[model samples]
Target: MIISSIGLSGYYVNRLVQNSEEIVKDNYRTLLYIEQMQEDLDEIIFNINNKNKTLEALQDYESVLKKQEANITENGEATLTEQLRVGYTKIKAHLEESNADANLIFKDIYSTKKYLNKIFNLNQIAVKDRNERAKKAADDAVLYSSLFALTAILVTLFYIFKIPEYLVKPIKGISKQFQEISERNYNVSLDESRNDEFKEMALSFNKMTKRLQKFEQSNLAQLMIERNRLNAVVEQFDIPILGFSEKNQILFANDRMLEVLQVKKENIIGKNINEIVSNNDLLNLLLNQENSNNERQLLRIIVENKERLFSKRIMTTDTEISNSDSLAHDSIIILDDVTDFIQKDVRKTQFMATLSHELKTPVAAIEMSTDLLTSIKVGKLNDEQKEYVDKINDQTRHIRRMINEVLDLSKIESGIIDFELENTEVNLLIEEALQTVQPFLKNKNIRISTEIQEQLPIVKVDNHKVLWTINNFLTNAIRYTPDKGKIDLSASLKDGEIHIEVTDHGQGIDKENQKRIFEKYVRLNKNEKGGTGLGLAISKEFIEAMDGKIGVHSEIGKGSTFWIKLKTNITS
Candidate 1:
């Protein structure tokens, strides 16, 4: 449409330009010739009156007239040119006479002047008429060009509104259907009745939706079956099980867990555990166990009028979602019935306590016998006899120490040990522990370097237990230190706790063994030992029971530092 409008406008503009060129070529040239002829006539009249060059003037006038005669274009211009030429011929003939009559020549001259004026007036009127025609042509060109442009614009606007209905509308509908499919709504299908490429696309889209719908139904049925099977297995278990999401929402609670919690399934599932924990003490304890830094402990609860022990174990599984980069943590809390195992362990502890007690008496009697055998009044032993006596004495002492360790462990396990907590000076505790290990230190010739911070605060702890633990640390330090190696004992107030460290320059423990060194019956060096392997374990229990912490920091070829942290009576 725009091209057609340009072509029409160009045609009208070309016509308008041709009309202007015609006006300039025909009428304007005729007006210029008449103007020159009028000037020549005035020259002929002046020359004739002066009688100086009348013949030349007449010849020039005649030449101009003839040219004007040949160039006639306007209406009535040719006849007027003939009259102008006849008048000019008569003037030339009169001027050619030797005795020229000025009156006749002048008469002819005025007549020719009249003809020239008439011709000039004719050409001027023609110029005005042609100018009006040219203006009318220009108006027609403007009108026609404007009409074509308006028609083109109207056609363009009509298509601008129509093109979207034909193209963009179908595309938008397809896009909407695609969005529905993304959201798992497979029931949507596009229209396939159109006879175009969109028809093919719609046909394929409908087929895909149908397949997806069938797959969704089958997949949903399988998922339901699997879910039912899983629930059945979890319900059959005797152990209490609870599952929670990262947001602390209770995802699932097995039948056993619901029974132990004394609540129905509907009351807890999909609910925030924190909200439920407020009203249920057992649930609160279970949740608290999940956040506790210590190892999971056994919980005692009365069920069906009988007391039972259950060990709480929390397992956290992190799952990565297929559509996300972040990990989802799911926590499963399992409470297994440990009543039978705990009962057996308690009986074993009692038996051990009884055996150690019985052995202590016999061991004490043997020590008394050795003393009697070594008495001066009894006899003067020979060198060989003295050597045997020394061996017996050492063995007996070792046995006594082992028995004492077993008794202490049994007491701690049975929960019968009492802590005599009191405010005791840090310096005095270090001195007392040193005094107990003095003999061993002397035997190894290990130098004891004491560093007590000035104005160190006292600690609130079980005096007997703390002293025992410190003595055990010092003894272990002395035993591990090479002969003539130096040992360090330091006490300082740190972080509202009194930190007492015993360092030994010995063959240090490796990184792997340092983790379980405090566990019961764990010996770092099995070949070089005189301990029951329960000393550090007992010391750990004692320190923990008194609200303190004990750990060792060691590295290969760098010696070991065994330290204990006890709460200070004075806050730092």
Candidate 2:
């Protein structure tokens, strides 16, 4: 558009310039020559009496007239010039006569001046016509240049508004497709019909999306197969297993879990567990395990018209899904069936109770019989008989103590032991326990020391049970300590709890055996002990029943510090 405007303006300007040059060269020169001829005609008429000067003026006029004749540019110009020439020749002939005729010469002079006037008027008219034509050409140049410029501007504005829309529309579509792909949706395809770079880009993008879709399908198939195999394996287990996503959505539930939940698989899988937990009490309890006090507490569930015990186990894992950099937390809740173990434990407790009860009577009778035989009123015996009676009494007393321990353990297991909770002073409790174990301490020749903290808080516990646990700790200390070994008993207020500790310098229990010392039938040193392995175990149960904690810290060759922490009366 700009080039066309420039070309159009240039053509019109060239025409106007040519028209001006023609006015200056042709019409202007003709007018100038006509003015010179008019001057010469006047001179010839004024100086007709002087022949030389008149002839000189006539020659100048004739020379100008000839130039005007050759330079005729307008219509009728040549005819006017020929008339002027003829008129001038007549005037010259009349002027050169022997007897000069002034009247005839003057007549020719007037006619030539008339002819010069006509030529001058014609050239002047031609100059005016050429000027008007040049003005029109200039107007046409301006009008056409402006038209072409306006057209160029309109075309430029059209492209300025429309080009971006044409370019950005497809790019916007492709960008939207990319966004969809980021969200794992590969269903979008761009228009490839465009005949540009965008078309090649679209084709390549479409090919990539197709490959990703196919790869995703293949991976999904493999994942589904693996998932099915895993589910099958989980279902084969006797334990109930349930799985959940980070959003509490149930991902999978084994057949055993579904059976225990008493719901169909379709009802729970892929659904939010929170939604199902509202109507299911057992499920609600299970889900609340994350915040429950006793996470490993056995659940007594009734299944198949019989009571079963299940212990819960929760396992969490971080999993990465395809096309994602973040991790998704998954939880697996497994319920292990311990019904048989619990039933067997109950049966064992029953057996121990019965056996201990039956053995208690025979053991008591023999202890009484030995006491009687040792009495002065019953009989006097030799050293050998005395030694024999003393051995029997000692053996019976140990058997009686073992039986009593067994009986206490059985009662504790059955939850039959009645607790007499009372606020007891720490000093008084330690003193009483020391008195009870004084005979053992004396027999073993063990030294005893007490370090009771002043102003210790009283503990709320079963006084007899606490005393018995302390006595057990003291007896064990005396048994383990060598002859003349020192035993330290201490009580203090610690962290709102009354800490009663017994430190014995003896063949100390090893680190490995310290943990199991409080478990039933776990005798740390088989060759050193003479009583049943139920003392520490019974002590643990007794202290725990009173809402206290018991533990031992020991090292080889050093002493063991057996301690129990009971909450103070105020704290309790």
lDDT of each: 0.86, 0.86
Which ranges of candidate 2 are over 4 A from the true structure?
Answer: 1-173, 193-197, 290-295, 318-328, 569-572
User: Pairing residues by index, what is the TM-score of model 2?
Assistant: 0.66
Please, what are the lDDT tens digits per residue for candidate 2 over residues 1-572? 58777787888688777869756677788888888788888888788789998989989988988898789887887887899889878977876778789888888888778878887888787788777888787887888788878888998899888978987887788888999998889988988888877888988999999999998899899989998987888888878999998999998898888888999999998899889999899999887856466457799998888899998888899988766799999999999999999999999999989998999888888988888888899889889999999889888888888888898988988989889888778788888888777778777788888999998876788888888888888888887889988999998887788888999988788877887889998887778648788888999998888889999989888989999999875652
Please list all clashing residue pairs in model 1, or write none if there are none.
Answer: none
**Top-scoring candidate (TM-score):** 2
- Model 2 score (lDDT): 0.86
Candidate 2 weakest lDDT stretch, 10 residues: 288-297
lDDT of 2 at 288: 80
After aligning candidate 1 to the native by TM-score, how far in Å is the CA of 170 from where it should be? Answer: 10
Model 1 segments beyond 4 Å from truth? 1-180, 187-211, 228-289, 301-305, 316-331, 380-387
Which RMSD values do the candidates have, in order?
28.4, 34.5
